[model samples]
Target: MKDLIKAINGHLAAEFQASHTYLAMSIWLRKKDLAGFSSYMLAKSNEERGHASRMIAYLVDSDETVELPT
Candidate 1:
């Protein structure tokens, strides 16, 4: 269970990193006047964030410690 929790936390961290990357891309696209692409990237970022949120909820429901990544 500890190992599983560790692995899940690692994946959660990756999800957050992906979200940040997408948000940066979205901002860059908007700056370049690509409204459609920017919106798409923004949606992707939101989706990644939602995934992370779900992971967090799962850990809490399982009564496991959630060690947030740095």
Candidate 2:
């Protein structure tokens, strides 16, 4: 169970990083006047955040203590 929790936490971290990168890309594209690309990146960023949220909810539902990354 600890291992499972650790794995989920790792995945959560990756999702957060991906979301951050996508958000940056979205902003950059928007500044470049590429609305379509920017929208696509924004959507991807939202999806990554959703994935992270789902993992957090799962951990909570399992009654596991969530050790947030510092």
Question: Which candidate leads in TM-score?
Answer: 1
Instruction: Provide the global lDDT of candidate 2 against the true structure.
Output: 0.91
For model 1, the superposed segments whose C-alpha errors exceed 4 Å read: none
Tens digits of per-residue lDDT, candidate 1, 1-70, equal 8889999999998999999999999999999999999999999999999999999999999999887877
Model 1: worst 10 consecutive residues (lDDT sum): 61-70
Report every candidate's CA lDDT: 0.95, 0.91
Pairs that clash in candidate 2:
none
C-alpha root-mean-square deviation, each candidate: 0.7, 1.0
lDDT of 2 at 55: 91
Best of the candidates, lDDT: 1
TM-score to true structure, per model: 0.95, 0.93
Residue 61's lDDT in candidate 2: 92
Sequence-dependent TM-score of model 1? 0.95
Model 1 CA lDDT for position 41: 100
